[model samples]
Target chain A: MNKLCQSIRFVAPFLLAICCIACSNDKKLPFYGQREARITKAADGTEKVDTVYQTIPPFRLLNQDSIYITQDAFKNKIYVADFFFTSCSTICPTMHRNLKTIFDAYKNNPDVMFLSHTIDFKYDKPSVLKKYGQKLGVDGPKWQFVYGTKEEIYHIAEHDYLVAVQEDQSAKDGYIHQGWLVLVDKHKRMRGAYDGTKSDQVAQLQKDIAILLKEEN
Target chain B: MRKIVLFLVMSTVIVTLIYSCQDAEQLEYQTYYSNGQTLYQTYCQNCHGEKGEGLGLLTPPLTDSLFLKNNRTVLACIIKNGATTPVTVHGKTYEEKMPAFPKLADIDIAQIIVYVTNSFGNKMGMYPYADINKDLKSCATR
Candidate 1:
């Protein structure tokens, strides 16, 4: 009886160790928890506050084809939107590069889309935007380059989406705006915004979009 | 017989506990991008290649030793505040102009750099984001 008890004790611990290792490496918890949390938080290190929307504003603009466009064109689609000018000498290139990633990812998903709004309506006429789109290699139809009146574009940029867009004549190029990508749901509510230049933030944007897509419609 | 069995059981339990109690190395593993890989795919892969190898005839490769060792300063500067002149990497000259990444915060640059360095077989030691932040001031302002 004593020998049996000793053997049982010895085997029990070995089994427990194996069990612990197995549990620690469980496939279900594949990602590190700390990293996941960081991705889910805000840049200021606080938890992100989700914005609820009651209505989406309406506006008119020109598409890359020189056709008249409006908010109604998006009707019921989930779209990712951002503001940039064709000749922007700063963050615009990086924004285009980053957005290309999102464009490629959902290029086949007919329901998902991209809207690149030009802050330089004067320069970014359909022809200019079409050429710029060619340079960036934007997948046609999946991504639309939009141009509208400076006043209306600036108004929507600042008030509606809360993005910064201004004409800064003092600064060499006479334009200024942060590089931001806003994700809007089917209902036209702002679900999230991402730093178009940073891949990690964009990835978080992708994840948030996925989350938003999964939400009950 | 019972005494032998008990001895064996106790030995097994001790061995298990001893092995399990070993402490893990205290290396600090930063959670980069957390979503960095995904973000890289979305924003950087188009120009930098899906793996930092640089797009052919368009951009220079980051993973190449020529650029990594020679132009670390210029590279850091260019990323923060776009590049103008044609630069060389791996002994070959690259003429493609890379635009600046000004909208990117200090942390974002760090994460992208780390992602590029570690991935695509670049393997530059994991530099802290703070270092990038310090370097960015001189690069962008100048």
Candidate 2:
């Protein structure tokens, strides 16, 4: 009886530890935006319910390389996306500086990607973006700096990514915008949004990227 | 034995305090330097970077001691009024127009100059706030 009690005490803690680990492994990043359940009849006459997640819609814009790219370019890949202009001197420098660290950290990982959309419709042409990208040390395919019309870019920024941007005459460089480094999952759903200018938020973004990568595989 | 012990303890305290004390000049430099660090973070750090390494080729790095020395007099003016002219730093030319900071006081500019020149691999000694007015006058006349 004494031997059984001792073994049970040891085995019970071991089992509890395994349970905790398994629970944590099952933990996944939360899905942003509204979701809904869809009920369907299965082949075996049972109901199968699935949650439909809001996803990044279709987008085709000019890249820094002067080539047109579509949403299909990021197919099966997770990406970090942000909006800024070449001449913005306010938060953009700090944002890009912090994001550059993340880019360097995940440079070798092909599945991870970066996308920057320029909101300046008047001046930020493809050639300017190319030069900016080259100077920013992100002249490659993994990090695509894109440019689009004010209508398309602003519409998508407001409706799709949930970031706010506008042109203000009194603002610096004639524009003002938020600095959100949005993290999107493999399915193109936003998993996290971190303030690109804050060190703590950027660090949290680094950790959350690892979590999302694990969740993807 | 107690006398020896007290002497040892007293000497240790005195030595520590003496080594920790900053001289008058050092105290003045520290006043500028520490305040300058905060100001740099607020104004220049975004473009110049935390290490003054500057971003890619878009912004010029502040590590060029020669350029700083050659343009040391006009540095205050450049801070006050933006620079549209291209600048050659470390053998590379940066053409982007630097936005002006008209809000900074002369003393604030002096503090930033001291901090930047001292940190980021730069060893230029203290730039007295008293000398800044003359430099600003020189720049305005140019």
Model 2: per-residue lDDT, tens digit, A55-111?
A: 899899999888999988899899999999999998998899899999999999988
Say what the interface RMSD of candidate 2 is: 0.8
Model 1: per-residue Cα lDDT at residue A5:
100
Task: Write one digit per residue (lDDT tens) for candidate 1, span B44-100.
Answer: 665676657654334566678555655555555776677778776766566645666
- Please give the TM-score for the first chain of candidate 2: 0.89
Q: Estimate each model's TM-score.
A: 0.51, 0.85
Candidate 1 recovers a fraction of native contacts equal to 0.04
Q: Please give the CA lDDT of all the candidate structures.
A: 0.70, 0.90
Residues B1-142, model 2: lDDT tens digits: 9999999999999987886674667899999999889999988999999899998778899999999989988889888887989999999998888999989988899999999999988989888888888888887777
Q: Candidate 2 chain A: worst 10 consecutive residues by lDDT? A: A25-34
**Predicted complex 2: CAPRI docking category:** medium
